[model samples]
Target: MNIVCIAWGSLLWKPGPLKLASGWHPGGPLLPLEFARDSDDSEELALVLCPGAPLIPTYWAYVDAPDLDAARAMLAAREKIHPGHPEWIGSFPAVDGAAVQPEIAAWLRARGFDAVVWTALPPKIAGTEGRMPSPAEAVDFLAGLEGETREAARYYVRRTPAHIDTRYRRLIEARLGWRPLHEAAVTRMA
Candidate 1:
């Protein structure tokens, strides 16, 4: 099966164990994304799909898996998602005839991919799971981070793909001056 992995954040730059058959390409589906998830252990306000967040362009690459199940397993391993929480790793056509994100599903079909997979971790903040912080709250959370944690948070926001601009990104840039780093700078830092 022709499978692809969708990404909007860390996966674009640091894919870790997720093997891709091709380099990331722009013009992936536009999804509602926001920096609402408080990353586990890192304290970075990681990006995740938010119901009412602004639609932003994401990136995609063909996965090197042989089938949908293998694709999902590879993505889950890359994202550190335990097998118990399969929902955290979203998949299209999860079951035959099952409904998934219609828009993304359509996009996938248009691109001739048999299936797509992405990280689907929920919004989290201040130890409260499923809680989505406002743009101001997200900025405050980043500002509150200190030392290495603060640097990591800054790096995440700045290294995010330039095309994946979102509401919180603008607020973070205006307030905390964490603008997206240019591609050359990002490559040099890598």
Candidate 2:
């Protein structure tokens, strides 16, 4: 089965254990994304798909898996998601022959991929498991981070792919001055 893994954030640069058969290619899909999830330990307001977030560009790569199940397992492991939370790891052509998300399914069919997998983690804010954070709240949360945690959060926001621009990103940049990594680097050198 020809399988592909899609990503918009850390997975693009830090694809720790997800075995990939090819480098990430741009133009994967445009999905609603926002930096709303307060990660478990890092406390970084990580990005996740939010219902009303702006549609942003994503990247995709062929996974080195033999089938859909293997691809899901590989992605789940890489994402550190527990097996019980299978919903966090989305798959196309799920057992019922329907894609997890209709939009993604159309993209998969157009690309000729037998299946696709991606991190489908939902937005969580301030210890609220499914709450989405507003742009101001997201900014305030980052601004409140201290020392190493602040640095880590800044790193995460800046490291996100530049093309994946969203409403929250603009707010973060304006409020926290955490621009994209390349922009920051160029500014530092200037």
Candidate 3:
């Protein structure tokens, strides 16, 4: 069997050891992607696929699976999803390649890949010990960092793709009271 892992953020750049059966292709607007939720694993805000917000650019890659059951298990495990709370995983229809279509959920269900997993962390509802910070709080937190940590945060914002509008890289800069890195880079080059 084959499974598709829809990606729009860090996963596209760093898939780790996860095997891919296909190259990344434009996956149609299936869900909203953003860096809104605070990451329990890191000080930085993490990307989430949520219900609200406009559709954003996304990519998908295929993975070969032994079976549907194993595909679900492997995906959930790979995405670090809790088994008890399956809502963290959103399953949608598989597009033949990069093509976009509506009602993908129904299509996937018909094809027996209904349990295919995509990760989304909704606002609030502590996936960790405490409630994840809101986007505003995350901005404040990032602004308060010092030295290398601050530079690292700025670099992360600088490197991230701009299509991920919800990352609010400019908002982070303005909130931090700094100029945009791209502008600064341009100034340096001149």
lDDT string, candidate 1, 12-93, tens digits: 7788888888888877898889889988885588999888777888778888888888888888898888777788888887
Best by lDDT: 1
The whole-model lDDT of each prediction reads: 0.82, 0.81, 0.55
For residues 28-87, could you state the per-residue lDDT of candidate 3 as single tens digits?
Answer: 345665556655544455566554656676666676666545555566676666777555
Whole-model lDDT for model 3 versus the true structure? 0.55
lDDT (Cα, tens digit) per residue for candidate 2, span 1-190? 8899888877877777888888888778888888989888755888888876678877788999989888888888998997668888888877524237666888999999998999888888788878887778888889999999999889888988777788888889988888887742211110
Compare candidates 2 and 3 on lDDT and give the better one.
2
Candidate 3 least-lDDT 10 residues? 181-190
Off by over 4 Å in 2: 95-99, 183-190
Clash pairs detected, candidate 3: 93-104
Q: Cα lDDT of model 2 overall?
A: 0.81
Higher TM-score: candidate 2 or 3?
Answer: 2
Model 1 misplaced regions, further than 4 Å? 95-99, 184-190
